[model samples]
Structure formats: C-alpha cells, structure tokens
Target: MDTNTKAFIGESATTFATEIGIVIRNDCPMNFHKWDLIPEAMKTILYEKLEGKFQLLRTNKAFMKYVDGRLHAQWVRTRGALSRHWKENGGKTYPQRARLQVHSNCWSQDDWDHVCDYWELEKPRVSMLIIFYK
Candidate 1:
C-alpha cells in the first residue's frame, strides 16, 4: 500500500479502536473483563455502532479479541475487499474522501475521559489490532 493509504488506515484504526473501547466501557462495564458475559443489548449497540457503518467485520472481531485478552489475534482480513483494493491499485493511494458516519450510541470525549478515569486505563491504541499480512 502507498504511504497515504497506510496512514489513513492507521488513523482510522486508532479512531475505530477508541470508539470501540468507549462503547465497551459505557455499555458493558459490568462485564468489561469478560466479553462473553456482555449482555445482548450491549452487543447489539456495539455491532450497530461499529460494524454497521464501517462494514469491517474483521476489524471489529479483532477489537473484540483484544477486549477478551486474546493476544496477537488477526484484526483485519488480508484476503478481503480492502486487501484486493491495495493489490489492484499498484501501490497508489485511495481516492481522498471523508466518511461522516456516526450514530447516537457513540460516546463523547468527556465520556471517554470518564471511562479512562474510572477504569484507570489508558486510551486505545492502533497497535491493539495485529494485522495479519499473508
């Protein structure tokens, strides 16, 4: 991938991870330590807020794995549409575009700060998603 596309991915991943962390912190605090224990309402909100708009199931799955403490799991799919775009584009960058996808279920910056303060945890990092390059 070109530098720009790589950078976009990095930035998006960070934002996506942050958003997911905030969701978990807000919706499933009672079960934060155990993803499987999260209630259906929490899972539904998370799925709609994250995957529904981004169409990145693999990336969402990776975040879930991270939350579950399953280390070194693949976060994004290498054999998927995103990968095909990179391979077919001859190392060029994707067309510059902005997607303003948001949902009512999202948390505000203040809420995120509260989560950090309450949980004594740091902000999410892009490194949490271990890309499995094939």
Candidate 2:
C-alpha cells in the first residue's frame, strides 16, 4: 500500500483500540444488565469508528484482517467483565455457554448477496453527480 493508506490504517487501528478500552470501562455495567445487546452495540460502535474512513478501508483485505484482530483482542480483554456479569446473575460458566453466545445460522445465496450489498457502498466518482442530486 501507499504511505497515506498505511498511515490511515495504523491511526484507525490505534483509535479503535483506545476506544474499545474506554467502552469496556464505561459500559460494563450496562452490558451486564443486557447480555443480548452486546453484539449489536459492538457493531454500532465499530460502524461509528469507521464512518468517515469506511471508503478508505472498504476494499482493503489486510486492513480488514487488522481490524478483526484488534476487535478479537479487545473482546479477550473484556471477557473477565462478561464472566463476572454472568456469575453475578447466577449463570454458570460452561462450554455450552460459549457455544450459545456464538450461535450461527446458515444463510442462502440471496441472503449473502444482501449482506454484500449492505457493506459495499460505491462512492460517486464525479462531483457533478453530487451537485446535481443535492
């Protein structure tokens, strides 16, 4: 990649890590109360973090993997808080609990197409398009 792209990814990754730490610290209590909302909340935070820069990293595979690794590591760091919440709620830790948390569903080809459509936003190449539309 070029220097600018490299710098952007590096800065974004650093910001993502810092934000994850702050989120875990401040939101642990709310998370404990609403276990089912965790995934959706995380997705929203990630989308917010990538808002202005999504066009930069959208087609970059290496950047995608870097982002995934950062999120996985942060999830690991916050596991203690999750476990504590479960324990306090009389939810015992078990192998099945982890499995249940990561439930997977089989999607048809059409569903996969929909997901791709949702993620792959194409920016207009011409300013005239924006000017005329706006």
Candidate 3:
C-alpha cells in the first residue's frame, strides 16, 4: 500500500497486459491459460498446448476482457512481469509469517517446509498460477 508497491504493481500490470497481447498475437499461451472472453477457437492452438495445466481463474473479470488481441497482450505482459517480480522478491527479506501460510497450502506441506527451509519469504495475499514456458 506504499507508493513504491503501488508503482511496481502499476508498472507490472502494464507489462502483463503487453505480454498477453503478444501471446495472442503469437498464438502462444504464456501462462498456460486460455482467454475466457475469447472464443476457444481463436486461441485453439495455444489452448491445445496448455492441456491440463489450465486452472481457470474465472473470477478475474479483467482477464476475461482479454478477448481482443491488442488488450490481451498488454494484460499478459503486465501479469507475467509482476509474477517474476514477486518470485524474485521472495528470494530475500520475505515475510516469514506469510510465507508459512503459502507453504501450508502446498500440495505437500512437509515437502514445502523442507524445500523452503532456507528461503526467507512473506505470506502473499495474491497468488499467481502462470507457467512461463511451454
């Protein structure tokens, strides 16, 4: 809620939006996700490639508006950049209490605890489910 955080989020959102547009243009699904507002046939190739990795975030209405190629790219770029930013931030000075909560939700809580034993991260209020690569 500070100025820096707000700036980062705003910048990152722009980057995500650009990325989404690029994805649609290239016919590639950057986060292994299909555009809900878009007809499946439009992004059929990308959708097909995503396969079972698709975890519908149906509640994000903003993402739903990505039916247009231009807007989709911008949305994806912003989201992708933000995701990377958060991940990098997690490598240092993470909020211990919050990270524990994420670790708690891990599919294998024990494994998450062990793997993250040395990581210092925070508990994030927002979660992202993007697969950057195919």
Candidate 4:
C-alpha cells in the first residue's frame, strides 16, 4: 500500500477499534472478530473518510480492496497486541481483568472490556493460541 493509504488505515483502524458499535457498528456476531465481516456501512464510512486525502483513488475498486486488506492486517496486529496485554495483565477475576489499564490510546475501557469478552470465548482463545504458537 502507498504511504497515504497505510496512514489512513492505521488512523481509521484506531478510531474503529476505539468506537466499536458507536462510531461504526460491530456487524460481526462476535464483537470485532472478523474484518471481512465488517459491514458495508463501515467500509463506506472509511471510504468517505479517505475521500479528502485520496480523491481520485477513492472511486477505485482496487484501491478500496487494498485499503480493506491493509485494514485487516492492522486489525490482526491490534488483536495480537490486545491478546498480549490480556495474558500479561489479566487476572482470575473479571473485575481484575476489566480494571487493568487499557492497551492502546485508541481503546477506551469499554472497548477493552468488549474485546476481552470476545477473547474469553473458546474459539477466539483457541485461534489466538494457534497464531501465537505459529
């Protein structure tokens, strides 16, 4: 991806990570689980957000697909970071886990909680473990 595209995806992913269901809807059944499952509304919003910086590129399908791919990669990295933070700081009790400091400036306490809740699920935990072991 171009520098401008990379920068935009990074910034937008941060906002999407932080806002979740507020700024953009969490269309996935499990909160923030899959990037491809992200709703068209959110993708449209990202495209609109990019309109100012990438006027001509905005209408390009290849450009949008590239942007979406980069966004997915960014989300994977964010999830890995969050997982690391959880393993390091999480406690036996939910309250203890919830009270831990947020992992990134992009995330609020509620966002952290939502992610933690998702990670608590068996599928996510197993998937992360596989990714970690790899």
Candidate 4 lDDT, 68-119, residue by residue in tens:
6655665666667666767677623453654475665334667777777666
How far does residue 36 in candidate 4 sit from its true spot (Å)? 1.8
Better lDDT candidate (3, 4): 4
Could you tell me the TM-score of candidate 1?
0.32
Lowest-sum lDDT 10-residue window in model 4? 21-30
lDDT pick, better of 1 and 3:
3
Q: For candidate 3, what is the total of clashing residue pairs?
A: 28
Q: Is candidate 1 or candidate 2 better by lDDT?
A: 2
Greater-TM-score candidate between 1 and 4:
4
Q: What is the C-alpha RMSD of each candidate to the true structure, in Å?
A: 17.8, 17.9, 16.9, 7.9
lDDT of 2 by residue, 1-134 (tens): 34544424467556656765554444332322233445756655654555544443646667666555555566555554544433443333343343233211212334323322322332335755445553
Q: Pick the candidate with the highest lDDT.
A: 4
Question: CA lDDT, every prediction?
Answer: 0.39, 0.44, 0.42, 0.55
Look at candidate 4 and tell me the lDDT of residue 54. Answer: 49
Winning candidate number (TM-score): 4
lDDT string, candidate 3, 62-122, tens digits = 4333324434554455445534443454634564443444321233444334334433333
Off by over 4 Å in 4: 1-30, 91-95, 123-134
